[model samples]
Target: MNIVIIGGGGFLGQKLARALVARGTLNGTAISRITLADVNDPAGIEGASLPVETARCDITDPASVARVVTGETDVIYHLAAVVSAHAEEEFEDGMQINLFGTLNILERCRKLGTAPLMVFTSSIAVYGGEVPDPITETSLLNPQTSYGAQKAAGELLVNDYSRKGYVDGRGVRLPTISIRPGKPNRAASSFMSSILREPLNGQAANCPVGEDFLHYYLSPRKCVENLIRTAEIPAADLGRNRILQMPGRTLSIRQMIDAMSAVAGPEPARLITWQPDEAISSIVAGWRFDIHADRALALGLAADASFEENVRYYIEDDRPGN
Candidate 1:
C-alpha cells in the first residue's frame, strides 16, 4: 500500500520515515511506496528496503497538496505545521498551512471516495485557559497562541470530515517531544530540547523558561511509536471520537537538568545559560500541559519513563555515530 508523510523533511518526520523503513510495513499491509513530502526533500535518507518518493510540495497550495495524495494512498501521517513562535509572528502563513493545509487534505480524501486512515499530529498547545490539574481527554480547547488555535480548529475539521465518512481520520495531540536531534529553530520550546541536546553536543544553550516551570514531555522514540500505533488502531474501536490525547510525564526544567547531570555528568549541565525571554516565558506560561491521557494509555501508548531516559535514548541512538 502507498503511504505519505506530510512533513517528512522535519526532525520527527525524518525519524518516523526511518522507523517505517526499518519496519518495512504498516499495520499488516506491506508498504509498496512511501512518499516523503515537505518544502524540501528529506536529505540522506532514501528508502532502504522499498522505494521512497521524496516530493517538494507546499502544503498551503491546493494544487501542490493534490500531487501528494492519490487513490493508492491507504494511510497518511500529517506532521506539517507552522510552529508556535513562527505562527504567532506570521499569522497568514500559519492559517494557510496549519488550518487550510489540513482542510485541503480532507477535501482531497473526500474526492478520492475511499476511507483511508489519516493520522494528524496535533499539539499540547490546544489546551490553555484554566485547564484541569491533570489535563484529560475531555478538556476544553482554549488556546492562547495562534499555533494552538489553528491546531484546535484543525482537530475539529478532522473530526467533522471523519464523521462525514470522507476519511477514517485520527488526530493525536502530541506532547512536547524532548531531546530532538537538531539545531535550534524559532519554536519558543526549542530550548526545552536544546538545553539538553546542545549541551550534550558540547555547545552552550539558553534556558528560556524558569527552573520551576513544569510541562509535559515525550521522547522522539515514543512519539514515532505512538504515531504508528495511531495508524494501526481500528476505526470501529475508536467509534465517533477521532482525536486521541497522547500520554506524557510532567517535569520541571530543573528536573531535566538534573537528569542530564546524572546521565552525562556535571559538564553537560554546566553549559546552560539562564537567559529568560519575556515573550517566550509568556507563551509557555499561557500553556497548560499536564496530561493524564487514559485513552492513549489503554491503546498501549506510553511516555518515556523519566527525563533521564529521554536524554539517554538520544545519547545511544542519535549521538555522532555507532
Candidate 2:
C-alpha cells in the first residue's frame, strides 16, 4: 500500500508516521511507501522500519498537492491546518489551508478515479456555540470561531466526496490532546499541554483559563492511535457519514494540576500561574468539554485511561534526560 501523510512536520503527524513505519503495515497490507508531505521538509522524519519518502507539498497549491497525492497513493491522512487561535487571527489563510486545501485533495482523488481511503483530521472545535451536553454524531454543527467554521466545512467536504464515491474518506474530530511535547504554538489549546509541559521542564507557564474550566483531552499516544484506527476501519462499517468523533477524557485544570503534583511534585505544579488571557478564554469558552463520543468508542477507538496516565506518559516518552 502507498500512504501519504500531509502536515507530517507537526508533532502528531510525526508520531503517526513513526507508528505506521513501526508497524510496517496497515489494514493487513504491507506498505510499499510512506510519503510525509509538508510545506517545508519535515525535520527528523526518518522511517527505519519501512520505505519512507519526504516532499515539500503546499496544501494550498493544487499542483503541489497533486504532485504528492498521485493515482498510486492508496491512503491519505490530511492533517494540515492553521490552528484555532491562529486561524481566528488569519481568516483567509485558515480558509486557504483548511477548506480549499482539503478541496484540492478531494478533487485530486476524484480525478484519479481510485477512491483512495482519505482520512481528514477535523477538530472538536466544530461543536462550539450552543452545543448539546454530550455532543454526538447526530448533533448539529454550529461553529463559532473561524477555525471551527473551516473544520466544519472540511467535514462536509469529506462526507460529500465519500458519498459521491470519489474517495473512501473518514473525517475524525480530534479532542484536545494534552501533554503535547513541543514548543507552544498559536493553538488556543496549546495552554492545555503547556501547563504540564513547561512546568515539568522547570519553566513557569500561565494558565489562561480557571481551574473550574473543563475540556475534553487525550494523550498524544492515543491521539495518534485513534488516527491510525480511523484508517483501519472498513468503509462499509463507517457507513455513509464517514466521520468519527474521537474519544477523550473530560477533566478540569484543577484535576490536571492535582495529577501533576502526584506524578512529579508540588514544586512543578506551583510553577503554574493562573493569569487569564481573554483571547484564549473566549476561543475555548464555547467548547463542549463533556463530550460522550459514543460512536468512536463503539468503533474501537480508545481514549486516555486517565489524566494521570497522560502526565506520566509525557514524563516517560518526551521528558528530557529520559
Candidate 3:
C-alpha cells in the first residue's frame, strides 16, 4: 500500500511516520511506498526498513497537492494546518491552510478516480457553543473561534466528498494532547503542555486557566495509535457516520497539577501560578469538556488510562532535559 502524510514534519506527523516505519505495515497492508509532504523540506530518514519519499508542497495550492497525489496512494493522512491560536490570530492564513488546504486534498482525491481512504486530524475545538459533559458524536458544532470554524467546515467538506463516493474519508476530533515536546507553539492549549513540560525540566510555567477549569486530554502516542486504527478499520464498520470523536479522559487544571506533583514533586507544582487570559479563556470556554467516544471504542480504538499516564509517557518517551 502506498501512503501519504501531508504534514509529516510536524510533531504528530513525525511520530506517525516513525510508528509506521517501525511496524513496516498496517493490518497486513504492505506499505510499499510512503510519501511525506510539507512546506518545509523534511529531512530524509536513514535506515528506513520501507521505501520513503519526501515532497515540498503547499497543501493550500490545489496544483501542488495534485502533483503529489498523482500516483497510486491507498491512504492519505491530512495533518496540515495552522493550529488553533495561530489560526485565530491570523484569520486569512488559517482559512487558506485549514479550510482550503483540506479542500485541495479532497478535490485531488476526487480527481484521482481511485477510492483511497483518508484520515483527517480534526480538533475538539470543532464542538463549541454550550456543549454538555460527555459530548457525543451527534453534538452540534457551534465553533466560536476562527480555528474551530475552519475545522468544522473541513469536517463538512469531508462528509460531502464521502457521500458523493469521491473518497472514503474519516474525521477524528482530537483533544488537547498534553506534555508535548519542543518549544510551545501558538495554540491556546499550549498552557496545557507548559504546566507540565516546564516543571518537569525544573523550570516555571504559567497556568492561564483556573484550577477548577476542566478540559479533555489525550497523549500524542494514543492520538497516533487512534489515527492508524481509523485508517485500517473496514469501511462497512464506518457506515454513514464519517466523523467520530476520539477517546480522552477529562480532568481539571488542579488534577493536572496534582499529577505533576506526584511525578515531579511539589517544587514544580509551586512553579505553577494562576494568571488568566480572557482571549484564551473565552476561546477554550466554548470547548467541550468531555466526550463519550462510543463509536471509536466499538471500532477497537483506545486511549490512555488517565491524565497521569499521559504525562508519565511523555517524560519517559520524550525525556526533555532541564
lDDT of each residue in 1-25, candidate 1, tens digit only: 8899999888888888888889988
Q: Which stretch of 10 consecutive residues in model 3 shows the poorest summed lDDT? A: 313-322
**Against the true structure, whose lDDT is highest?**
2
As for model 3, its CA RMSD to the true structure in angstroms is: 1.8
Error of 2 at 137 (Å): 1.5
In the range 144-172, model 2's lDDT, one tens digit per residue, is: 88888999998998999999999999988
Error of 1 at 49 (Å): 1.0
How far is 199's C-alpha from truth in model 3 (Å)? 0.9
Residue-wise C-alpha lDDT for candidate 3, range 73-191, written one tens digit per residue: 88899999898778877899999999999999999988888968899989888877766655788888888778889999999999889989888999998988887887766777889
Off by over 4 Å in 3: 131-133
lDDT of each: 0.87, 0.89, 0.85
lDDT of 3 at 290: 69
Please give each candidate's TM-score.
0.96, 0.96, 0.94
Between candidates 1 and 3, the one scoring higher on TM-score is: 1
